[model samples]
Target: MDFARGTKLTIKYNGNVMEVTYISRDEDYLTVKLQNGYNITIPENKIDVLKSSEPQTVKKKRITLKHGNGTPISLITTGGTIVSAIDYETGAVHPSTDIRRIIDRYPYMEEKYTIAVREFDNILSENMQPEMWIKLAGVVKEELGKSHGVVVSHGTDTMSYTASALAFMFESLTGPVIMVGSQRSSDRPSSDSFGNMEGAMAFSSTNVGEICISMHSGTSDNSISLHRGTRTRKMHSTRRDAFRTVSGKPIAEFKNKNVDFLSEYKEKSDKISLSDKIEEAVSMVYFHPGLSGQDLEKLSEGKRAIIIMGTGLGHISQSLFPSVRKIMSMGTKVVMTTQCMAGRVNLNVYSTGRELKKIGVVSAGNMLPEVALTKAMYLLGNYPDEDFESMMNMNMRGEIMEREFLGDCY
Candidate 1:
């Protein structure tokens, strides 16, 4: 009762050392906000403060509390533009672990969900790697067992790649495993961080169970679209609605503090599975005019699988056929996915494609090149005995489009 709000103190309780912000208290108990964005009420007799509030370093601190009878959602943080801020001293924007600030700016979000923040990584998404993906999978796997759902806040640069990877690594996930990001940082007035985060929390509490993305649906804050993890892509650099669902409509949309399911989704199940295995000896090459067979040869060397973002219809020049043949002869898997975003890759439709297939290259159908790469790694790591060619073309997690289309489409 003597402590005031915003008081910084070091407290030891339940065998855990935590730096907390002292909030108000009731007649019987005292409430404190933990460093990791959790609010817990404890008996007054249990309080043990090692330090008290001082004005020398006083600054704004956030206090968060769980909503009564609210759904429990794990907020896993991976460094991205969404949680980044410009370090005026360094003149560069860097990922910040101060996630409580974001929640503080949007206090209304805590009213709907009992949020628990977990820091998985604090680096830019561009720095994401296979090992990080494996670690993230393990963390998500553990969290899903205890929480109602999990929401990952990641950077937009490689957010889709991580989302696609998680879609395959975690099979038969029942609860909503949604990834959310901000196109703009929180410091700006026009930031999309608030809407995207709000939408993700809303979607996470729903019955729909799948790995998905919740982001801006349009330029305005009208709605946030929920896209299947495998079918989503960041289509623009600066737009709030940068991510678009490829070859399919968004599975659901969040608006007016509600999630409206637009398409049928995997319902929440009692079981969840995870596979952290990944073969990192895979690479991708984007085909362009005047690319050499020597380049292809070198790219395939010491690689288990190579994904080619080939030209239209998934064709490569006949000049590179010899190098491709040699690579496959050495037991390297060559998979082809088109640079074009919307259509299925057909090796039999073109002369160049037919020639490439004659040697050993396999088509990735309508899978995004990034998805193809991750799937290749996943298959090579987990199901090494299975036929990868068949698996690549199969509809696993809705990565491939059922019907092929021509021209520009979203």
Candidate 2:
């Protein structure tokens, strides 16, 4: 392949026209940005070069095919920093669709596992909707049922949110369903994409499950940590390793080309089942100093559960406390989660906490309030008649801690 950065070229396939103005030749994939404003990674071998109209500066392209154990790895694209490539015009990065190219560039990953890369969509994790999750669920069902493990490339901002959603959707999911993303764009030299993907793929081939996050355990390439989706949180804005599992220990680790487990994971089962009936609809609202109750009106139409991302220690103003009471009394189950990224939600710490709890706000206890908000909808959708109190408070797929202190007392 003679393709290089700034080389003007075009590609076509089944109605999808891809023009290459900028090319990032990564170790595993050839990242090309289409003139149409989206980025697609074409494995170097997949380049059906239409033509080179301008001068081309050929950069060395490294492609390798290495295999690990005979694990079937499925890389599902759900839009995230991990799969996005560099933009030549503004230098901004966009969602990527070429997993095979990544695999080829980093042959060490492909050699250890047979990988499948498919793009479901190119939206940031925060932009993800339940309908998208439903679609992703179908894609995951198809892959995990046949593949040894699966990796979902998602945007870091909403990576934890989707992971939490999948944890609730997957009933007894066996094997690893890893969601990997990069806090820093992969265009940067210290980007965490490859390492995160490697960790995720390694875990997917193993027995880890529910939905887990494969990200920098620390701020380096030396190690990657696997935190359960429902338990993990993105704790930084610019750091390569930002996702962390608060209150709970990690599910596993990836270091030095090996998968090590700190805890056991969900295993493969005999009978497989699929359900598409989802009826739950919930919303997440951040509680601010001058918060209004109109947002609760969206949930007020019917029996809706709302999760309020409250201030420190789960405190909401006494003004919203009445609205909280109103929502609870209106048959909408509202839960409370701390805005603090770390520590648990303590409803008994202050009178405000006690007042909200008294008004029937379920304590989310650092469960990444958005996950609680989303899960509420999923369960409500599935079991329309079930009590929201039990479902919201109950530890479904390890989303909630058993008590305030489930670890060392000190």
Top candidate on TM-score is 1
lDDT of 1 by residue, 1-410 (tens): 56755677788787777787776578978777777767778997876777887424333222234666677888787888675666443234555545566568666665666777676766778999999999998888877776788889998989889999998998778689889999887878999997898888888888776789999999999999999888888899999999988877889999887789887677877788788799999999999999999999898889999999999899888888888988998889999999986877898987898888888788898899999999999999988534888888788887887754342354
Backbone-clash count (model 2): 16
Clashing residue pairs found in predicted model 1: none
How well is each residue in 240-293 modelled by candidate 2, as lDDT tens digits? 767877776788888998888886556655544545444555677787776666
| lDDT for residue 165 in candidate 2, whole number 0-100 | 76
Off by over 4 Å in 2: 1-69, 86-101, 273-280, 292-303, 348-351, 403-410
TM-score of each: 0.81, 0.76
For all candidates, what are the clash counts? 0, 16
lDDT of 1 at 403: 56
Global lDDT of each candidate:
0.82, 0.72
Q: Supply the global lDDT for candidate 2.
A: 0.72
